[model samples]
Target: MADRKFALGTFNAGIAPFPGIVIDDTVYDARQVVPHLTVATLLADWEASLPALTAAAARPVGGGISLSGLRVLPPVTPPGQLFAAGANYRQHVIQMAVAHKLGAEGADPEQLAAAAAAEIDERKKHGEPYVWSGIPSSISGAYDDVILPGGWDDHDWELELGVVIGRRARHVPVADALDYVAGYTICNDLTTRSLVPRKDIPMMGTDWMRAKNFPTFFPTGPFLVPATFVPDPLNLRIQLRLNGETMQDSNTGDMIFGPAELISYISRFAELRPGDMVITGSPPGNGSHWGRYLQPGDVMECEIDGLGVQRTRCIAEAD
Candidate 1:
């Protein structure tokens, strides 16, 4: 068996990459590092470029950004808007159902009932499928802090496998969807459950972006592992640790919808561009269950099979 290929943050000690593109405190031009290529383009060009990407992996290039010098940015620059699904996993949906039944204390009973009724109506209208959160501010590099904004006492971490679109896909068939993937990386869809004032805010309507997409809400990878390396995306393990203690541990197999299906399902309405990202749902272990929340100086680590680990520390914004 041959070795696999991966991309790293190559940066300089005195220079930075670019605005919004941060690596280990130093920034670099993403346009230069990430070839203006999509997943489909890479696959088509694989036969020829494979050797070069492989050679780089085998031999270290001098004067290049060392892993220590460059911080791992989210593998791809976020798209204009990002869409995420809610209760997409059967187990997660069931858990939320129970939590909703417990009811939110201090909320008006009649209003809560009305909200529940509305949710039932929407369920009849759309079945189990729902999408929400056009998160623009949530775009941040993988190593960036998963900020715990004040007032968010129920901050949580979700271990997810993120997929990057490599082509312009709209209404693509599931059978051909995998062809549009550029690669896969590890993502921590950090969220704050306290933002939803009432249980009535349907999972989709909770502005999950506010909880999930803080400035550095979505911390992603060390680097992207080309799709070719992931023969079975569903088989990968997804694990997360808080302050060096294992908090969540599960496999991608637990996802309600596989990557190919998610890509195809999302493409039906919106066009998935070369750099757009979709975070497949997370596994069971999250901070909420342990009654823990992110505090200043907290550290989080997320790792997925094939893709290496991404480590980040939570810090307050510079005054």
Candidate 2:
């Protein structure tokens, strides 16, 4: 068998969507060879399932399905305990703070980013990552349409690197945290910027639950590239374009806390189980910084190096 890298994705195969081993454009059903194989089962025993998946994926199997005709679903269906990071990127944190407090009235995106850069330079060297839980139902497919919730016009795009856990972890040390990672995928952490702050209760601060977890808020994965394929997750390029205009262009290196650090930090208080997804915070170039927000008929093209692309369209929710 020729050496080729394979990723796992969920696709509609008749009655329901099932996990399939994806190698390039062709998707092969491993269930034909390994009975009752699902994404949950594979992740439940990632170590053992990986080799089997690799072998099955590479085989010149009978009647392999074409990925084009199939409706791709979120990589991990009923996605495991989702934990998302906030203000984790150096520039993103700066941009978010500037827009939220000072407003982007006259500031150019570059000026705002620079001002944020200047102030965020004094960030704590030993700060902990900010993480919050999300429901699996909020997840949508990579190519899915995003319905902007009614009456909220400030929907924004936050292209983030998603980390999938392969092991049950608790109090995991930063140095050894990457070992618990199963694979990596792209996640668009959609948020409603206008709803972020709480005026009714100033002390309560951000309202992440209302701002972040709307339906189809998290567009995750065209594929789940195994950790082995991604030799250096920190160096990958992250980019997003709105209506063919480049919006966010940054690298994972700008993250104040890398995937390992974020995972390890979150695990200190929460037990991260297999299939759980950790959204490593987004980089700069959000709508808030640019003073633009999502509008109906807009197209968001999101991509991360080697992880494939997600092209999602936006539509206004009906009243």
Candidate 3:
């Protein structure tokens, strides 16, 4: 047996979704060794289950199945809570601000970018993350189709890094926040740009529910890579290709508030239990910023360094 890097995910061939340990291109049934551990349960008892999972992945590879024919499912279905950060990436925030600027019309493009960069630096020094909640029902599998709902057609993609919580955290300090994380995954947080800002009530700002929580809007997980494997989550590369064209290409190093700070900030409001998630904000390129949005038959491929890739197709809702 050899100890090596592996990921955790859920798969379905014909029956119910089952947790598996992924080594290279093969997947071994997790229940073969750890009968009591599902992806959700493993995170609930993450510290205690690590050794067993590691040993399981080290076993001989004969009984494992190939990954090609199986259907990938959401790693953790109906997680307890789903929290997300907004405007957290430096370049993304700046790009959005500049793109939708109501003032500073006379400034050059370079000048605008510099001014936005400076503002981001100031915000980093004394700012808290912009966090919001999402319903569990919106989650779809990595390879599933993203349904572009009717009555609102401005669907846009925001590929982000997702953080999975292992330990219960309440009012945790920033210094020790990372101790509660179990793993990380890829998150494709699709938004309805047309419904984002309430035209009915301009003072209401964003309507996150209508804009973000549509069914099958959140496509997540090809694999969940443990924190031990991702030593530097802040420096990983995040890239997204829509219809075979690179739309979003940036690094997590551009995040103004990292997972530690975001978690610490959120812990003050509610308890962060095992299987809960926090999606770090998206990077610089988004469909809305490019004046393009998801249409029927569009394919989006999202990838993060170390974690596996997620490929989702877009389908428009019927008339």
Candidate 4:
């Protein structure tokens, strides 16, 4: 019982349990504790330390801090580094191209009307690629609030399936790439649409870091379901909601660039270490499509088939 693979975290009532390294009653953050173990020293080792982790975790943690009373922290506090794919979905790419074209020319009344009609017609066709960078310092654990940054009047939610690396993969072959994955987790790549314009080239251009990377921008976790649990990461279902209203609804099968290809491509440039996370892009149904965006006090929820659902609320920036 002390040397077996087990998922840790406070599981009771409404509190979302983050899969972590449970050492007695004190659950050291999973990402933090993994570094203490040298083998693989990355997400791929999510299962390698089973024997030692189970034994250490079984030891009774002194003090009266029961599991239920603990507030879950981000599973992997520092993921070496974080990067995200943009417009990886076939449908999302098409939508982005149309948006960019419409935004390019539509200043006049005649142009605005034509652009509107073109946009509607384009919706029937596929879109193109659009990229943006996410803020890594703003990452948070599941069940945490995503505080919308100041100057951002319209925030948005993007439901994405995050990939956790399992080993030191550098230019690994796509066929064997999936083997390097440790597991999967849910990530809400919250964005400020009004701030991150899809325009081509403006006088000042665009800065996605400020628009997408605010504190708590990447709300992740609930659990890192082992890869064994997800034989085919591309077949799972993904869904998102705002205050219970379904926003993003789709499946991994819709991804144009699959996980293996993405991992291999990224590793070509950087030596992806343990705990490094890659948000594999989001599906359609973003607030930008609608006239409104995330308002303070709105609750956002993201769910994947194997990975447990992640729920967070929006808050105003502090004065």
Q: Which should have the higher TM-score, number 2 or number 3? A: 3
User: Candidate 4 on 1-319: residue-level lDDT in tens?
Assistant: 2243334332322454333554334444443434443222534455555444545455533333344566655556554467788867766555555555545453654455466556544632554323334566777878988887777587878889988776788988879988888778888888877666546557667767767787888888866655765778999899998899998899998887778878877877778777777788888788776556888899988899867777898888889
For candidate 1, write residues 1-319 as lDDT tens digits: 5653455332223554321122333233333333534333343344444455555444434333435655444555434346665555544544454445535665564555555555545663465446555465676666666666775467778777877666678999879999887677777777778774446656554555445666778776656666777899989977888899998787887666677877888888888776566778877666766668788888988888778788888876554
Give the Å shift of residue 201 in candidate 2.
Answer: 1.0
Clashes of each: 10, 0, 0, 7
Mark the 10 consecutive residues where model 1 has the least summed lDDT: 18-27
The positional error of residue 123 in candidate 2, measured at the CA in angstroms, is 4.0
Q: On a 0 to 100 scale, what is the lDDT of residue 94 in model 1? A: 42
TM-score versus the correct structure, for each prediction: 0.75, 0.92, 0.95, 0.75
After superposition, the stretches of candidate 1 with alpha carbons farther than 4 Å from their true spots are 1-4, 8-13, 18-65, 78-80, 99-128, 134-136, 197-205, 317-319
lDDT of 1: 0.63
Q: List the candidate numbers ranked by TM-score, top first.
A: 3, 2, 1, 4
| Model 3 TM-score relative to the real fold | 0.95
On residues 110-150, what C-alpha lDDT tens digit does candidate 2 reach at each position? 77767776655655364577788888889999999998998
Top-scoring candidate (TM-score): 3
Model 3 lDDT on a 0 to 1 scale = 0.88
Worst 10-residue lDDT window for candidate 2 reads: 118-127
Number of clashing residue pairs, candidate 3: 0
The lDDT per prediction is 0.63, 0.87, 0.88, 0.68
Query: Please, what are the lDDT tens digits per residue for candidate 3 over residues 18-130?
Result: 88889899888887767554688878888877788888777744488899979988887555589999999988977887787723788776777788888888889986789
